[model samples]
Target: VIRGFSNSRNPEKTIRAYIQMLKTGFSPDHMTYPFLLKSLSRLLNRKLGGCLHSSVVKTGFVWDLFICNSLLHMYGTFRDRASARKLFDEMPFKNLVSWNSILDGYAKCGDVVSARQVFDDMNERDVVSWSSMVDGYVKSGEYNEALEIFDQMMSVSSSKANEVTMVSVLCACAHLGALNRGKKVHRYILDEHLPLTVILQTSLIDMYAKCGSIGDAWGVFCRASVKESDVLMWNAMIGGLASHGFIRESLQLFHKMQESEIDPDEITFLCLLAACSHGGLVKEAWHLFASLKESRAEPTSEHYACMVDVLSRAGLVKDAYDFISEMPIKPSGSMLGALLNGCINHGNLELAETVGKKLIELQPHNDGRYVGLANVYAINKRFGAARSMREAMEKKGVKKIAGHSIIELDGTPHRFIAHDKTHFDSEKIYALLHLLGTWMDLNVNNDDSDDYHCVCS
Candidate 1:
């Protein structure tokens, strides 16, 4: 009963049953304590888990492998690395499971650096050990590091990568926008006959979409069994189409999804609303927002912010401001920031000031808040106010992050700052750039329809 309840959704029942057993003067044995400790870990009841640890010690089950493993899992889930490490070191005997448990704790708690240390110290490893580090690096936004680890898993370790490991690799590829590398991953999955699970298919769709291969994304989407397509798969495809400006196609897919009885989650509606926003369909966005209110998924702060973006993007700054005024929840920084952007584009200096200050108060450390307000002041011919905004930002110790763009060429990323000439290929790069700029200037204002740089706008 303890093990059953521990594995069930309501793990608290396990704890209650154990307490009843104790009150009835029944002593739980080694077998019982493992399940009980598992329940505590699932519930993340820190104090209760500590009490159970003491109980385990008193009952002489602390050395029990299963119980100790459960305790390590609980500590890892709580991100209490210190406790996990201490118990791990104190273990009279340790197995691979024990080592993996501690490594998992370090990684889950956002200490991938320490997790790597434990991983390196291991004399032997399985796919789980390798996958953990790759997944950890992926979670930490160390995409390049993740890719390097995966390469090593394939080459150095000669370890066969599994579906879960491939997922993280694909995710890293998607983020890096490495279309060639992503394509290689896709081929590997097919070559290995790795089951094209919903998650794997969704990752492929996202990777192709972000890598500017929407047609490839569409191909994958079209070939998938529509009956077996999950909501996440649907969301990924719809989002991909929407992002690529296939707004009508995305809407059409949404209708098809409804016809198939696939319930639209919050992300689905957000995708639709964003498509409408980008397509400048203000009326359609309003209708979609109204539909969201009627759907099972309630609008979150992000949904509300997207709606504000729709209004602001369409140059309806005043309407967006009124929408904020009537919102049930307080305006988030992003929502107000959208309104502020609308104010800038529509030349509504007065409201921009109010929104700017509100944003600053809400997020005092955000450097963009000061820069945005300063830009507005400069635009409004208030030079002194613009200068004062910068001064205030400096007084608050806010520093604007340096802006740069990373472009991947020939499978290598080259980062460039504005007016930077530090790259080894700077001379040739600048020569070509100069020629392109001169050609564009020559083509500008041309009446020919074939001209690429015609400045009709």
Candidate 2:
């Protein structure tokens, strides 16, 4: 009964069954403790789990591999890496599951370096070990590292890359915008005859969309839709189309999803709202927001922010401000930032300054916030105010972060930052820029048309 309850949703019932068994004088042996430990892990009741650990020790089941592994998993879930590592070191013998649990603990904590150390130290590894490490790197935003590890896994490990591995690798590809590499991964999936599970489909759509291969994304979406479509797949397709400026297609897909009786989730609405924002479709945005309100999905802060962006982008900065003022919850940094952007774009300097201060206050450490406000003032020729803003930022020890851009060329990413001189040909690059600037000045001024000579920059 304990095992049955534990395997199902209700950990509380699992505990009750265990208590009832104890009252009936049934001692928990090796067979029973693993389930009980699983229950505690699900409940995340550290107090209860600790007490049960003591009881297990007293009951002489501490040496049981299954129970110990369950304990390790429980600790890993708790993100108590130190405690989990201590327990791992104390174990007389460990198995594959044991090592994976400890490695996952480090991964969950975003300590991918430690996870790699553990990975290197492993005598043997399976898909789980490789997937955990790859996923850790992905979660930590170490996209290059994730891909490097995946390459090593493919070259060395006989264990097949599972759905989890593909998802993580595809996520890495998406972040890097490595279209060529993403295509390779897609081909690999096809060659391996990997099942296009819902999650894998979502990752594929997301990868193609972010890599600017919206046509490919649409193709995948269309193919996936031939089967009984899930909400996640629908959400991914909608978001992909929406982000790529295919507002009409995204809306059509939403309607198609509704026709299939597939309910939209929060992310679904967010994607649609983003689509509307991109197209500056104010009426469409409001309609979707109204629908979101009528449906079971409560509007979150991100939704509110997206609405603000929609209004702002359409030159309704004041309306966006009023809408934020009427929100049930306090405006988030992003919510206010959208309003500030709108104010700046619409030339409402007074409101821009006010919203900018609020945004900076909400996110003091956000370098962009300080820079945004200062740039607004500088653009408006409010030199004193702009200088003051910069001074205040310096006073607060908030250094403006150097802005950078990355472009992937021939499957390699090149990053350029402000004042960066790290590249081997940086000197030549700066010389070319100087030549271009001189050419632009002479040609732009010598233009016959007066309008052509009136350059804003």
Candidate 3:
């Protein structure tokens, strides 16, 4: 009965059964502690876990390998890394599972430094050991570190990288825009004949698309479509094509998706609307936007933002403003900012001023809003208003943040900012830029002269 309740899906019942066994004078042995600890962990019952830990010590099961591992895992799951470490250190005989469990505990607590320390201390590591560290780095937004660990795993480990490792590595490559590295992983998958699970396939498609290889993305999509008809896969393909400005292909896929049994979700509509906006298909955008209601998906602020972008880009500033006014959800700063940008592009100073004021109120700490509005005033020759805006920002202690760009060269990422000379090859880079500028000037002058001669003739 105790084991049955412990193995049950419900943690509450497990605890009750344990209590009932204790009341009936039945003492739980080492075999019983793992399940109870797991139940406590699942229920996030730290107090009960503590009580159980005391019982384990009293019953002389403190050194039981399985029980200690369970206790370590429970503490890790609760994010109590200090207690986990104390337990780990006190253990007389440490096994591979003990090392991996503590590593996972530190990683789960967002302490990658400690996790890496644990990882480096391991004399012999397996797939779980490597995967935990890689996944930890990825979750912490240290994509470069994750990629480096994956490289190390590939070079040293005899154990094969599984689907989970591949997915995490692909995500890192996607964010870095490391097309060369992404392609290498793709080739590795093919060479190894790894089964293309839905998640692995989706990650591959997304990685190829984000890395600027639309053709490869489409090929993966086609291959996956033949065996798997999941909506997420279709969404990835549609979003990828839309982002790359392949609106016709994106729309065709959307139509094809509708023909299949897979239903469209909110993300699918967002991609469709974005495609229409990029392609300047105002009519098609409106149709797709309205179709959201029929598909039983409520329009989120993101969906409304996409519509505003579509209308604003089409030079319909007034219509975009009216749409925002009627939206069920409050317009976010990004939504208003999109409309403000459109107003600036179309020289609609009146709407720009209105939207800019609302945006500033919504995001007062954002220095870009003040700067953008000040620029608008300066463009319209309202020098006094522009000066006041800048002064206001200064008084509020808001400052413009420096902008930077990242470029990946030969699988290595380089970052550049205005006036940045940190790169070793800065001189050569600047000289190349000057030569490119000179060439562009010559071509522009020649084109103007030819146009002038043609008009006179």
Candidate 4:
């Protein structure tokens, strides 16, 4: 009953059942501890978790690999990496699970360097080990490294990548836009006839969408076995099309999703909302926004922001303002900023000032809000107000965050900033930029508009 309640996500009920068990003199065993530990970890009751840890230690079963692994996982989940590492170092008999536990700990804690060291030292590695390393690389935003490791895993042994490994690698590919690598993975799946679980299919759809291969994403969606077309699959397809500006196809798929009798979730609404925004379908956006409640999915602030963006961009300024005013949750600075930016874009200076005031009031110390407000004023030729905003920013001691852009070169991230000279090839890069600018000025000036000049910096 305790485990059932816990698995059902009813923590309070689980605690009650556990208390009844304890009062009946039913001592909890090791198996009982993992569930309780997870429940406590989920609740972030670190105090009670600490007491449970000491109790596990007192039971003299600390050497038990299962118990120790659970403890390590609990500590890591609770952000107690130091304690997890201490327990890992003191463990007497270490198995693959034990090693993987600590590796996962490091990965979840964002210590990918240490995770790589442990991975390199492991005498044997199974699917779990590879998944952990790949996940670590992905979490650290080292997408290329993750794909390289996936390649290395395939080369070192023909053990075959599992679902977990594929998911992580695909996620990295999605982030990095490694379309060629992703295609290779797709071919491997086809050749190996890897089992196509709903998750794998969903990941493939996501990967292709991110790689700018919506056609391929559609292929995956079409080939998904009938059972695989769940709400998640529908969301992935809708989002893939929506992201790529395929409004007609996306809506068609959305209607098909409805016909399939699969209920939409918050992600589905988010994707459709994005589609509406991209296609400038204001009426459709409002309909989907209203449908969210019927789907039993409450709109998040982000959803409201998207709606506001759609309405504002379509020149429904008053409606957007009313919507934000009536939002159940507090509007974030970004939410109001979107409306302000739209006002600037469409020359609605009065509403922009209102949004600017609200944003600065909410996030007084945030330089971006000041910058946005100033930009709006500058757009309207209100130099005095823009100058005042800048001066107020200076008086508040708020510094503008450095502007930088990261581009990957040969699988390594290279960062460049305004007037940055810290890189080894900074001079060479500047010279190249100058040459490219001159070439474009001479060769392409007549063909392209001044809009291309925005990237000069």
Top model number, TM-score: 2
Q: What's model 2's lDDT at 431?
A: 84
Error of 1 at 170 (Å): 1.1
lDDT (Cα, tens digit) per residue for candidate 1, span 218-306: 99999899888999999999999999999999999999999999999999999999999899989989998999999899999989999
Of models 1 and 4, which has the larger TM-score?
1
Which ten contiguous residues of candidate 1 have the minimum total lDDT?
448-457
C-alpha TM-scores of all predictions: 0.91, 0.92, 0.84, 0.83
| lDDT tens per residue, model 3, 196-233 | 89999999999999999999999988877543768788
- The TM-score-based order of candidates, best leading, equals 2, 1, 3, 4
Model 1 per-residue lDDT at 445: 50
Ten-residue stretch with the least lDDT total in model 2: 448-457
Better of 2 and 3 by TM-score: 2
**Candidate 3 — number of clashing residue pairs?**
0
lDDT (Cα atoms) of all candidates against the true structure: 0.90, 0.90, 0.90, 0.84
Q: Which stretches of candidate 2 lie over 4 Å from their true place?
A: 225-227, 424-457
lDDT by residue (tens digit), candidate 4, 1-457: 7677767766767667777998999988878877877777677778888988888778776677888888888887787889988998998888888888888889988899989998998998888888899999999988878988887888896568888888898898788776777887878887988888899999999989987889999999998875557888889889999899899789888888888778889998888888887788998998888899777888887798889888878777778899889988888886787788778877888898889999999999999999988988888889999999999999999989888866655444466788999999888778888988887778876775674533432
Residues 37-72, candidate 2: write the lDDT tens digits. 899888999998889989989999898999899999
